[model samples]
Target: MAGGAADNYGGVFDGSMGFGAKPALILIDFVEAYFDPSCALYAGVEEALKNALKLRDAAREAGLLIVYTNVSYTQSMIDGGRFAQKVPPLENFVAGHPMGAWPKGLEPADDELVITKHYPSAFFGTSLASTLTANGNDSLIITGLSTSGCVRASCVDCCSHGFIPIIAEDAVGDRHEAPHKANLFDMQAKYADVLPSAKIMEYLSELKL
Candidate 1:
């Protein structure tokens, strides 16, 4: 860890948040646009999607509280606010748009918690924080698409909200490898404990939830 350029920075961001029993798994922005090769937002994130589904299965078997997020805007796109303006392609997520739908295997079950937002950070204007707190989830395992955008934003917000964020590296992705890898490094350095999917599964094994 000391050999990297990031090592020059003070130890202010060093240290892990460790694991907790009541961990909730968050699968962020896995909409069809991210996976559909024909879509402009597609990133060929097949590997990340595979890893996420595996973790999703493991979480279900372990009976962990799972949360899913998707970007949904009104047909008028007025509800999208500033973020939607920043990324005009986000118009795909507007109501009636096919790209807003979650991919087949990753769709949330009827009982699973669903958080809809028009912003990057899930906690920005959503009830995710209160919901996780109410469910007694002191730790959050985040895995999803676009590491540099929503994933990074959600990781920082998750930490700020006082929940230990465990970012599953193998299960998160981006349109390109560079930003994906860069964000993961920065996140591990500043905001969260970045772990591979296998390691997260190990943490899940010991949980009674």
Candidate 2:
């Protein structure tokens, strides 16, 4: 399931589901641990990181509020509960772990926000919602790793909190291609506007605000 080929559906997603303007960028779990092949992460993560970097650059130029989410647990992992138990890889994602740190290439800017989350959804048990609200971000452009788990969780939670979730399809990946494809398809059908990264770039380019 890890190395299987995925059918890339370029330009196939519907974008009308998301907010028309005022978009922000949320990059989730793009950490060294996820990018290292030696760890329990995806294979083509290097390629995904390249796309995410491009997205981040464009968002920054467009004056979008950029937020990065990292999974950091306590030494005992007592705070995460059942979610962390089911996914034992999370236990290694402690605050000081090298794997918990953001990938060097996509490190946060001084003005950007870096959120430490114990759970999958960035909005859950974090100040992400309030931050977005304060910044007047009604729509979110999500780019990250492990699409099936954290990405999907954040998308639904963002929608529930009244923020339109727009997944940068080419900018998100998972430990396995199957879960990536399945979650993208599911998010497209139900929660978020699953658009390719290129299309989102076009929207940002045309923004007059």
Candidate 3:
């Protein structure tokens, strides 16, 4: 028998996209803006950040292709586009801004792909799809800040691109607990598998490499 909220959805949008053989790691917008208490966009996500570090380390050890996404805009912010307009806080990503850099210890390796975008989904107007394709990465292990925003968009786009999206629930954070929990439930029900960080780390560790 379906239980409570599970029954309310009428059995729709309830299936896993599952894992693909070639997995890649995508760290979305894990920058100073979202982590710094002094910054306007800060979310007080230290716990999540620490877990993400563990995930990153596991990915590195497992030899997975690591991809990190951060927003960047012209000094004029003209290239920020509509999404930026809707959320003016995006200006924090402008060139030369203090918050534009990756949070300490979360920095990308010199050889890792660093994708910069002006929008929500990392794939939009970016070379992420082709990069993933070129590297033979068919699954995305995703983490980062603001669960209701960029993280959600990136996962949906990952699914649309035929890449399996595996969202590490403990590795993603939101400024508020409500949206974070809600989006995780919604993504698990529809777009992706929301798993604990330890499970994800174990999966990566057990890969053939």
Predicted model with the maximum lDDT: 1
**Each model's RMSD to truth, in Å?**
1.8, 4.7, 2.1
lDDT of 2 by residue, 1-209 (tens): 23333233334544457455799998988888877777765356677788889999888888888999988788999988888889887766876888777777787989999998888888899999999888888899999877988899999999999999999999998868888999988898678988888988989987766
On lDDT, who's better, 2 or 3? Answer: 3
lDDT of each: 0.89, 0.84, 0.88
- lDDT of model 3, residue 127: 98
Decide which is better by TM-score, 1 or 2.
Answer: 1
Clashes of each: 0, 0, 0
Instruction: For model 3, state the Cα shift of residue 150 in Å.
Output: 0.2
lDDT of 3 by residue, 74-176 (tens): 9888898778788898888888898989778887889899998888898999999999999999899999878999999999999999899999999999999
Which ten contiguous residues of candidate 2 have the minimum total lDDT?
A: 1-10
Give a tens-digit lDDT track for model 1, residues 100-205. 8988888788879999988999889999999999999898999997899999999999999999999999999999988998899899988899999999898787
